[model samples]
Target: MAETYPVLQEAEPFYFEGNDIGILVIHGFTGSTQSMRDLGEAYAKEGYTVCGPRLKGHGTHYYEMEQTTYADWIASVEEGYQWLKERCQTIFVTGLSMGGTLTLYMAENHPDIQAIIPINAAIDIPDMAALQNERETRFLDAIGSDIKKPYVRELAYDKTPVKSVKEIVMLMEKVRNGLHKIQCPALIFVSTEDHVVPPGNSQMIFDNISSRQKRLVQLDNSYHVATLDNDKELIIEETLRFIKRS
Candidate 1:
C-alpha cells in the first residue's frame, strides 16, 4: 500500500496569467513551489505568464518522495509545459538544482522551448559512487536551503530519501547525454560557494550544450538556492534580460 502525506505549508502550485511568453519555474529535489514563488511572481509582474508546478512526491514528505521516480517528476513538468503551450506562443524554462536538470531535459526533448536558465544544476555527482554503494541508509541529512542570507530559508525537505537521490542521478545521466540535443539559448548560473551542487557542473553544462547563444554567470553572494538567497534579485534581473534578448 502507498502512504499519503499532507502537503506542507506554502508549497502549493502557482499560476499567473499574463502576456504571450510563458515561463515555467521548477524547484529542486525535495523542494516545493515555495522555493520558486518569488521568481514566478517577478516574471508575472513583468507581464509574462508563469507556472510553478509542485513536483510529485515533493512538498509532502520525504517518505512520499521515496515512492516517486524521475519519470514522475518529469511528467509534472510536462503537464506544466503543455498548459503553457495551450495559451502562449513562446515558452521559457528555468529551474534550481534538480529542477535545472529537468529544464535541460525539457530543452533536449522539446525544441520549441525559446530559452532556458538553469541555476546551479547538478550534472556530475562527485560522491555518486559512494551514495550508490550505501544500500542500508534510507535517508540522508537535508541538502536544501543552502542560502548565504541570514534568516532566509527555502521550503524543502529536512531529510533526503536515498531512493529519490538515485532517481535524480539517473535523470542527470540522461540529461547529460542529451546535452547536444539542446540548441536553445541558455543562461546558466552557479554560486561561487554552493554547498550542494559543485560549481563545475555549470561549466560542464555550458561546454556540452549545443546552444550557440549561452552565458554562464557566477553569483558571489549566494549558494545553491540562489533564487532564495542574497542574490535573488540578480537571478531575476538576469533571467528577464536573457528572455528579452533570446
Candidate 2:
C-alpha cells in the first residue's frame, strides 16, 4: 500500500493571520490535498498562511468518490475559507485543473480574495458534445488496470465518477455564460498542448473576466499538472507577483 501523506486529523494553518497575507490552495478532482503540498510549503516559507484541503471523497478509493457532487467539493473549500478567515485577513485562492475551477467558483462569490490564480484551468472543456455521446467509454477500468505511467502522473487511486465529470462540464458552461460577473484580479496560466484541458478554456477566461489587472501566461512544458510540470517555475513566479500586488 502507498504511504499516506502528512496525515492530519484537522486542517493545518499555513501561517498566522497577524501576518496580513494568507493562501488557500485547492486540489483538483480525484486528487488529494497533496497536489498543492509543494506550493503550500513555498507559501509558508514566504510567511503566508496556506491551507490545502482534500476535496470531498478524495484521498481514498476512487469508486467510493462517485457519491460526491460539485457542491460537496465546494463545501470543503468553504470550510477552508472559514478556517483561514480566522487567522488571515486576506486570502488568495489557487488551484490546478479542477481545483482551479473551484477557486474561480469561490472567488466568484467571495470577493475578499486578494487574487485568484488558475493553473491549467479549463474555463471550458472541449469535446463535451463528443464526451456526452461517449460517456460509456471504459475510463475507470482502463485507469485501474493500466500501470502507472513513468511521467509521475499517477492518479490518486480514485475512479472518475461519470456523474461528477458531467457536473464539472456543466459547471464550466454555467461560468462561461456569467464570466462578466467575475471582477477579481485574475491570473490564468495555460498549457499550449495540454491533453486534458483544451487551451481555449484559459483563453476564454482571459478574454471574458472583467478585471483589468488580469493576465494570461502560456506554458509549454507543463501539460495539465502545472504544479509539478517543467514550467512550474512560471507558476510560482507569476503567482508570487499576484500575491505581492494584491
Candidate 3:
C-alpha cells in the first residue's frame, strides 16, 4: 500500500480582513501557504486585507504535484485576486519564487493591479532545457526549503517531482516572454546568496520589465526562501514602505 499524506492545518489557506488595500500573497512551487502566512499576517496587522492561497497540488504531497501544472497554480492566485477585487478598491500583489513569476504574469494581464512585489521571482532559469530532458525521471532532492537561517521551516514537499519541474520551466518561459508587458510599478527583492535560483534570473526580470517605477533590493543574509530566512523582517518592512510610497 502507498503511504498517505495530508495537508497540515498550518499549511492551509488563510485570509484576514483589514483595510481597502488588499494584498494577495503567493507562495512558491512545492511550498504551502505556510511560507507566506507570516507575511500575510504582518500585512493584516498593518491594516491591509491579506489572503494567502495554497497553490494547486502543493502542501499535500509530491504525487499530487506530479499531476498538476502551472495553469492550475495560477488559477489559485486568480481566485485570491478575484476575492480581493470584490471587497477592496485597490489591490497590491506580492509573491515569492514561482509566486513572483505568477505575480508578474498577473501584472501583465491585469492593468488594474496597482503595484507588484516579486521576491526572488523565477522569471528566467538556468538550463531549463536540461530540466525538461529529465522530466521522465521520478524525483530529485527538494530545494524548496533553501533558507540560510538555522531551524527555520518552510512547508514543502520532501522530494521534487521532475515532471512538475518541467512545468515550472514552461511557466518561466511564458513569464519571460511577457515581461515587457508588465508596466505596473514593481518592487523586486533578490537575495545575494540564493542557492535554488541564480541572481541572474532576477537581473533578467529587472532588465526586461517595462515598469517605469521599479527598484531592485538585494538581501545579504538570506537564501532562496528569504521570507523564511534571516531577512524576513527586511522583506516585510520594505514591502510596507513600498506600498506607502507607491
Question: What's the true lDDT of residue 131 in model 2?
Answer: 60
Candidate number achieving the greatest TM-score relative to the actual structure: 1
TM-score for every candidate vs. truth?
0.98, 0.84, 0.96
State the lDDT at 245 in candidate 3. 88
Order of quality (TM-score): 1, 3, 2
Error of 2 at 207 (Å): 0.8
Inter-residue clash pairs, candidate 1 = none
lDDT of predicted model 1: 0.93
Report each candidate's C-alpha RMSD, comma-separated, in the order given.
0.8, 4.7, 2.0
lDDT score for residue 62 of model 1: 92
> How many pairs collide in each candidate, listed in order?
0, 4, 0
All candidates in order of lDDT, best leading: 1, 3, 2
Residue lDDT tens for model 3, 10-81: 788999988899999999988888888889999999999998988888888899888889999989999999
CA error at residue 197 for candidate 1, angstroms:
0.3
TM-score quality measure for candidate 2: 0.84
Pitting candidate 1 against candidate 3, the one with the higher TM-score is: 1
Clashing residue pairs for model 2? 15-49, 17-87, 62-158, 62-159
The residue ranges of model 2 lying beyond 4 angstroms of the native Cα positions read: 1-18, 128-151
lDDT of 2 by residue, 20-92 (tens): 5778888776666655677787777778877787776676655546666778888988898888888887889
lDDT of each: 0.93, 0.71, 0.90
